[model samples]
Target: MAQSDTVVRILDTAEALFAEKGFAETSLRAITSRAKVNLAAVNYHFGSKKALIQAVFARYLDPFCEEFNQELAILEKKSEVSLEELLEVLARCTISVPATKGSLSVFMRLLGLAYTQAQGHMRRYLQEHYGQTFLRFTNLLKLSSADLPDAERFWRIHFMLGAVVFTMSSLDALRDIALSDYDEKTRIADLVARLLPVVTAAMQAPVPEQPELVKQ
Candidate 1:
């Protein structure tokens, strides 16, 4: 294989391993062995273990982020669309290719890793990459629910995303008990349509907080 092909194979092997088994559990030797490359080749291609993991994410995340941002732009350009339309677009962006469980699951597993790892790199990535977009999303929510305060808006954004991630990651289990007519391929649109109302309604009203009493 060409050197570039070797690098790609290493990343593919690493992404699956790291996603399923996690970074600490997945070793460089295991990755090289699976990719049929040598330890030196892994270093030459990626330089280090961290670089490889980041490359694995970049392989999937960068494209999805660009596509989702472009889709958001197009949605905004369209005249006076409903909140539900926006929600549906957000949901559909996730499963761009239903057949490729590799991409979507990889992302969720990466997210799981970031959550547990709690490293500076993941923190920086979230703050710089995802957090900026997250703030932009807050502005969009403002368009629909202009009255909400900053704190509420922030949590609501997290709430909607939590809904999307959990649901998308677990769609198959939900489908098994679902009506016979339902299939992930055919019914995702319908599924998003149904979810939009509940999500939008939840965001529409002012989020209430429990009263804070001073502890002596």
Candidate 2:
């Protein structure tokens, strides 16, 4: 196999394993076995287990960050963009992946693992590559919801991320139950459409005032 093909095979196997077993549980041996690549190849292609994990995340995040940043750049050029528009862009980023990339569900599971696992390395790596894109996202959120206090905006952004991660990661279980229990077809695309409004509402929610305390 070509060197590039070998690298991709390793990465593809690692991504699936990590998504299924998580960063801590999945081992290099398991990955090598699944990828049909020898230990020497894995060591040659990726120096260590940590580096392999980072590569697995990069496989999904690089494309997502690239597409999101491109859309964000265009949106910024507009005279004005609604909060819903911004939310839709974020929603579309995850949902559209399945159509364009065959690994949407797996990628989402990996993303959820990123949040739950010790992701400092992966997060910092992506940040180094996509810091400006994230900064732009924060700035856009500030502009779109000018009324929100800085603290509120920060927390809400985290909230939005949590929702996105949970929604995407849980889709499989949810879809299964829906199919067995209700016989209804709950697709990722449909869920994304429903999620947009909830995320927008969360982002645009009014900042609550600190309540006055009565003497106890």
Candidate 3:
């Protein structure tokens, strides 16, 4: 096989395994075995497991970030952007990315794993590479929800991320449950549509006044 083909095969195998088994549990041996490549090939191509993990994310995130930044640029030109409109731009950019190796659900599962698992290196890699795009989005969010205090916005933003990660990572299961329980077929786009308004509302929620602590 050609060098690029070998690399793509390795990446495809690693992405699937990482999404299924997570970063720590999935070993290099397992990845090589699945990819039909040897340890030397992995080392030669990626140098280290940490590098490989970051590469896996880069495959998807690189394109997604490019598209996201473009959309954000257009939105930035507008005089004002609503919370829902900002979120919709995010959803549109995310869904527009081509999932070559697996479904978007797999991509989301890997992302959730990166956040939930003890992958400090992966977090740093993301922040280092994608921090600017993330900051831009967050700045736009701050502008859209200008009413919210900093602390409240911080918590709400994380809460929104948690909801999205959980929902998208478990998308297949959620779809199955919807089919079995409600006789309804759910699509990924449908879920995003449903999720946006709920998160938008949460982001736009009224900040509650701090209550006084009672004496013990």
The prediction achieving the highest TM-score against the true structure is: 3
Candidate 2 runs further than 4 Å off: 1-3, 98-102, 211-216
lDDT tens digits by residue: candidate 1, 37-142: 9999988878988778777766556666676788778866765656676676666665573335445646665766766674568667667766755555555657
Clashes of each: 0, 0, 0
Candidate structures ordered by lDDT, highest first = 3, 2, 1
lDDT of 3 by residue, 1-216 (tens): 334988999999998999888898999999999999999999999999999999888877998999999999998888998988999999898888978533687888888888889999989999999999999999999899999999999999999988988888788889999999999998778989899999999998788888999999
**Candidate 2 similarity to native, TM-score:** 0.87
Total backbone clashes of candidate 2, pairs 3 or more residues apart or in separate chains: 0
CA lDDT for candidate 1: 0.70
The residue-by-residue lDDT of candidate 2 on 1-216, one tens digit each, is 234989988988898788888888999899999999899998998899989987776666677788899899999999888898887887787565423343776777777676678878877776787788789888888888999888888899988888887777777777889899999898778878888889899887778886899989
For candidate 2, what is the lDDT?
A: 0.81
TM-score of 3: 0.93
Give the Å shift of residue 49 in candidate 1.
2.0
TM-score of every model? 0.77, 0.87, 0.93
Q: RMSD (Cα, Å) of candidate 1?
A: 3.8
